[model samples]
Target: MNQDRILLEETFYVLTKKNSVFRVRLTRKGLSLIKESDNQEKKQTIPTRDIIGCKCLRSRKSTTSCSCQSLPRGSLKVVEENSGEQDENDISAYLYIYAYILQNTKSGSCKRERTIITLRFRSFDKYEDNNKEAKRWRNTIKQLIKGEQAQNETPDTPIMHKINEQRKLLVLCNPKSGPGRGKAIFQDKVVPILQEAEIPYDLHITKHANYAREFVRTCNIYQWSGIVL
Candidate 1:
């Protein structure tokens, strides 16, 4: 337990930069023991299992009134673990974001079709160690890649059986996205599938901002299966 006096409200610096959600892990029994602003103990336990994902929120108390939940998933490595090492790592723990599902009943008119059951939940995370976080990310990527390949694979179609070479796709990338892995992710996770499916693609590196856009404006649209932005 690497305990640090981290203020939850001020931790959005790392959260916003990551383009990720925050989460926390606590069982029903644990939540019941939490003290509220009124100095009264919570009479009930909020289920931890109900959490999924959350949109980043500015305040945590607002969601508490509703069945919504939130958890912290990762942490940032701000300072060096030791002095004069000339290196530092981003340190964070895994957390889960959670919320509840609710249904709405309308007045008058008897229409079963109009009834709606919508999700009324938020998100948070389960705190985990740095090594654990790395392992979790790796496993998740592998699982997602495997699932996508399984879904895209087709055995019956003649086109699937044969290699496709007639089409060429050009990928234009932007580096501003969180983690800066947009292009690498496409190459590692997407390109292999394209190759297996026998689709031809050409990758053109953009030297400056808006380079791809300027190129697209003057080019013939019929020449490709649409230019990817």
Candidate 2:
């Protein structure tokens, strides 16, 4: 199997003397052998249950914090240095990290669709554990941003206020980003919040790279005050 495209718990089938039989194996890379022989060519689907075990371990959500996940480490490190310490416990600190991450990505320039945020913290003792910390921060930030703040809190309790935005939104999804889970994240998580808030927004699914740019050019910027990538 090719090392580039293997997924965990992926399977493939093989033919035998008596009849065609299903041979299952787990591939962590989501990869499976596509049999293409002179005698026969066919497509086989591997069910998650069929996998007795996986060759590759599932990636933790904290992977987003790693330098290798999408952007370079040095770049993130430089941004972190500029922002300050990568403190997971501090809300402001995590927000700065989130801003830094977005800055490194090419799509950071997309207008003010919403407050782009990142949260970081310590993970396991051995590893840097940025991803784990980032996720924890993400949850906390979302709760605050979505009007979960207490109205009658004392000075001691932190206040969570909504940041007013200036425009409608169109979220352009990149399937490749976040290991093909970007779209799912938007659908399952982002969409509901936008709807609950009565925020005017649309979802555009892209099949290839650079589709967002093309879509943006054709789209009427006036209709949507903001664009999220």
Candidate 3:
């Protein structure tokens, strides 16, 4: 199964060169910039395969700006601000730049172009602390991207076996016990959560007093990772 695990997440107030501020969610998938007042929700999904490089920059200067000329269609123009009265609250001394290539379909043909996205988190206190946090995030993301690239390159290689976090569970339900709501409880509450977590499970209702013990004794224990009674 191809799954993109979330390596990290951070909420940052992103400032554009245009002087507009947005609450952005930075994740392994990409950035989600939300502006409630303007009803703007911009999302940038950069696949690990697309990421080419990442870097962190610290500036002693008061102003910081970023631009992207070859961004994909529907990509938000988030980093454009004309020189104007700087807001006192706009305090970002460090910038994290991520470089990647986006594939766009133009006239039924696929085209690839390089794009750059810059983001900075709000720092209420010291500028040095902000720079350090930005650098940490930059390094972490770069390492994850590099690992993804390596995994892709060695697709045929045998992956190291690891314990599954979401393992198959055998749920033993005594439907006739406990107010006779076991079935209802599993159906109404438990099933939805299991489905949400993508957990595989098997439900077995007890038919008699000794049914559970007998089933366990004869059942193929190897098939189930764990039992939940």
Candidate 4:
């Protein structure tokens, strides 16, 4: 009895960087990317275990307005030419998926290669509406990733993907923590650990004394998932 259910599915055009169109779907197992052009269909599946992290980003601004017309199907050259031509009025949300896949090296060994899949979702009249959809997908993907990790760590642990907040971590770094080694400590020690754990954090360097304290006092703690000092 194969009981894998499709959680979410959407057909999106114009992958920002790659400029390819795809219909993406999510299941409990993995993400399926399906591309079809000129009656030829292709599919690539990224196992949930390979995906490290995913993030949703809002576009800055575009001078040229973007519209989905007859996309020159399978033509990379045309796609690249018009990729950056987006309208300032377009309120689009971008979703970035990070995964590591094995690649054959010239040295006759396999190496883990990081690939980022950027998805641009838009076409709605309202920005909020588009962002909401993007966030929904982000939340689902994040929870699935976390739930798998939790299961691996403890077989008997109860996994709750619904409760994990997709909030940025506020990191306060002291430049003088070790008289001069604070930067090194953060880069060499803290960063690698955070990356491996797949925690998204925003870094802030304290310049004057009590800077972090004063900032936290006035800043909204609700904006952050957690604070790290």
Candidate 5:
């Protein structure tokens, strides 16, 4: 996987069923759970495609002051200390985190049954931050699932029989052409036709003579299936 294409990579405190926290690496590829003592001794990977859904959980009541009892388990402890009492709503303080539900198929089983895996993040003081992170993760996981679904839905027919479904075109116009009627012509004539035909196009205006030719020479021609003047 290209590192440049990685959508998200962050260290999150995973909450366990025993009320313990484990430091895990959340990335586009999957979840990498790191061991307490060693980094590589005990590691687990969960592919992003396995994630079924994610939900952001919020506490019913908001509080300004909070404490963590299990710091030894690598939990994040956020404590805001102020001399005067402050309203929780004013501070925008709340306990929130993201919960991801994953499903994995059992291996070597006669009947295909999915094993449910629940992963949760540690609580955060600010509701906004928690909600933002949860939404980001949810969207990324959804994109992965959508890509997988699209791949599965595509036909297995040969490439020769396949038709290009993408409607893309490039339109070039000279701003000074025909006594400065290029812009007006494009707006009045070209745009309406393209819209009526339901065609998507990239428009470029020429600044001077031979400008279109120069642009065409430098541009990536592979992006457009057809070019229109």
Candidate 6:
């Protein structure tokens, strides 16, 4: 199995909260959003590492959060009578991809800014049917974010072992570095980010002098994807 290979491919008609339209590609490297306007395709690729979380939702006809009524011009109709095959409200299902991509600041430096990609599913008339497809995308995206399940592997497979758990990061913190502020700073600034990204980690607090150095010298560093100091 080639890790670099695209496990699954999907083409989506994505609508943002601001009514922006873009073409989306789900690949191992990143989620590419290419904008087409005036017969031009301006492309921007959001790195897969920047993606944080994703969700699949089925909006009720009454909710304003993401109703089909919010769709822009020439978008799919929410309800179509396909020989009465749909038994419900014929609502649309939505998949939301959350990411923190880098944006250039006015100060000429780059900072991460949160962005969302929303896709509406109306291929099926029934809400349940539409939502099922949304969930398939959500699940696969989550696997990609976590670097967990492989394309051909089942959800129940011990996939981390197949990849040797190389996705996890090892954090070596000095509890005494900031004279009691070190732990506080890491918890306040770093832990939230790690948790939000669903990134697994092994934290080791230095108990004595040269603790981080000794651990690095003796430990098999390859076990960790990266060492965080």
lDDT of each: 0.35, 0.41, 0.56, 0.70, 0.50, 0.70
TM-score (all chains, Cα) for each model: 0.27, 0.28, 0.43, 0.57, 0.38, 0.55
Q: Give candidate 1 regions above 4 Å deviation.
A: 1-165, 176-178
Q: How far is each candidate from the true structure, as Cα RMSD in Å?
A: 17.7, 23.0, 20.7, 9.2, 18.0, 8.8
lDDT of 1 by residue, 91-183 (tens): 333222223423345764442211111111122332234424434433322222222211222344122122123657767766543377767
> Higher-TM-score candidate among 1 and 4?
4
TM-score of candidate 5 on Cα atoms, chains taken together: 0.38
lDDT of 2 by residue, 26-145 (tens): 232221334446878654433322222111111222324543344332233312422343423222212221111112337656332222212122234422354444344333334333
Residue by residue across 33-117, what tens digits does model 4's lDDT show? 8988899989887887788777666544433355444334332221211346433354677677888888899999998777667
| Better by lDDT, candidate 3 or 1 | 3
Angstrom error of the Cα, residue 71, model 5: value is: 14
Tens-digit lDDT track of model 6 for 34-143: 77789988887778788988766544333445433544544432322343433345457777777889889999999999777778777776767878888787777777
lDDT for predicted candidate 6 compared with the true structure: 0.70
Lowest summed lDDT window (length 10), candidate 5:
90-99
lDDT of 5 by residue, 1-229 (tens): 3322445545553444244344555555665565565444566666665544443333222242543232344233233324233323332221222223343446643432232233443356675665566666655555453343222122542222232338478888877876789789889967854553346788888788888889889989778868888
The runs of at least 3 residues in candidate 5 whose Cα sits more than 4 Å from the true structure, single-residue gaps closed, are 1-6, 38-40, 61-107, 110-125, 148-229
Worst lDDT 10-window in candidate 2: 50-59
Worst-scoring 10-residue span by lDDT in model 1: 113-122
In candidate 6, which residue pairs get closer than 3 Å at backbone N, Cα or C atoms, i.e. clash?
none
Error of 2 at 124 (Å): 55
What is the C-alpha lDDT profile of model 3 across 104-193, one tens digit per residue? 575777665655556665564754576577766666555445443222223563343443545588999999866899889888867855
Model 2 has an lDDT value of 0.41
Clashing pairs in 5: none
Error of 2 at 179 (Å): 0.7
